[model samples]
Target: MSRLVEATTAEPANPEPVFLDFSSVQVATASYLRESVLAFRDLVRGRRSTFYPVIANANDDVRDELKELMRLRGDVLMVCTLGPAGDVNMARLIGDLDPKQRMTFDLVHEHGETDAGELMRAYGESEGLKHTTAWNNRLAALAARGLLMEVSQGRAKRYRPLFEDA
Candidate 1:
């Protein structure tokens, strides 16, 4: 642990987000995970928010163990994929988002880019949303969470899934 900390101390002041690509790594034990990753996480502590130490291409067992860690520790670990599509824990991913934000995120994720009007119409029949501003706010909230992106279309806005430039 001390050696790991010593090595980490030499990391660049503004370190790039670490990507733990597990494509080649097939197996791991909980002991090694605790010794390496948990220790690293503790060493870094909280000098950041959002993406860092992202694990990608983790197999089912590894992902499950990481999920267990997250459940117990209550800390989020971002996951990255080589391509755009991948699965993540939607409930964990949507932390603190209200119903509208959740719905907006779902809509955007399901259908690529969605305009406010389209979203409003989709839910309008059920929710009685007559004004456009409410839908805008919902999409904006999702965008703020980095789950969605806002694009300009003439005088309107469209929300799309936040695709990382992997």
Candidate 2:
């Protein structure tokens, strides 16, 4: 008779709250996909928020993991990043989640910086997007909705979150 070997891996007994940020290209890679799932599960052991800038190529898998985490913790907010596409994508993703149970917010400001035009131009070139009037319109909408607040309006308009309770 041949002896059979069983391997066991220990999971997190107590998980800590985590905020996940993923790169669009990274999520598409097989290695990153596996890492993302494991990282998400480990992060959600206690409480977690899965934040992504936009619906990248790897959104499906991330979304699936988020759904499973929600089932366990009951407090998962999937942040869909909306660039120049506007609020349609944001609304669609949030609508798919448990609307009444979870809270949704468009992550507009980072580190109390809100000059989106300059920031967009600098970053959009790499993303294959343009900094145009249309982009400004999209940003305006977010500002109107209280998602982004302008601290200084001039050549450079610094922006930050409306509230920093968290």
Candidates in order, TM-scores: namely 0.46, 0.31
Backbone atom clashes (below 3 Å) for every candidate: 0, 2
Show where candidate 1 strays beyond 4 Å: 1-78, 81-96, 163-166
Residue pairs with backbone atoms closer than 3 Å in model 2 (clashes): 53-81, 114-159
Q: Put down candidate 2 lDDT per residue, 1-166, tens digits, no spaces.
A: 0110011123223221122334354324434433553344333322221111123222666666545554554333334433354322332221232421111223343344545576566556664567645445555444332234444345555545433432
Q: Give the least accurate 10-residue stretch of model 1, judged by summed lDDT.
A: 87-96
Model 1 clashing residue pairs (backbone): none
In candidate 1, residue 3 scores what lDDT?
Answer: 57
List where candidate 2 sits over 4 angstroms from the true fold: 1-107
Please give the distance, in angstroms, between residue 137's alpha carbon in candidate 1 and its true position after superposition. Answer: 0.3
The best candidate in terms of TM-score: 1
> For residues 1-166, what per-residue lDDT tens digits would candidate 1 score against the true structure?
5654564564554323444567777776767766776666545544322323546667778867766765665444545554445443221241234566666666777888788788777877677778778888877655443345456567877766544321
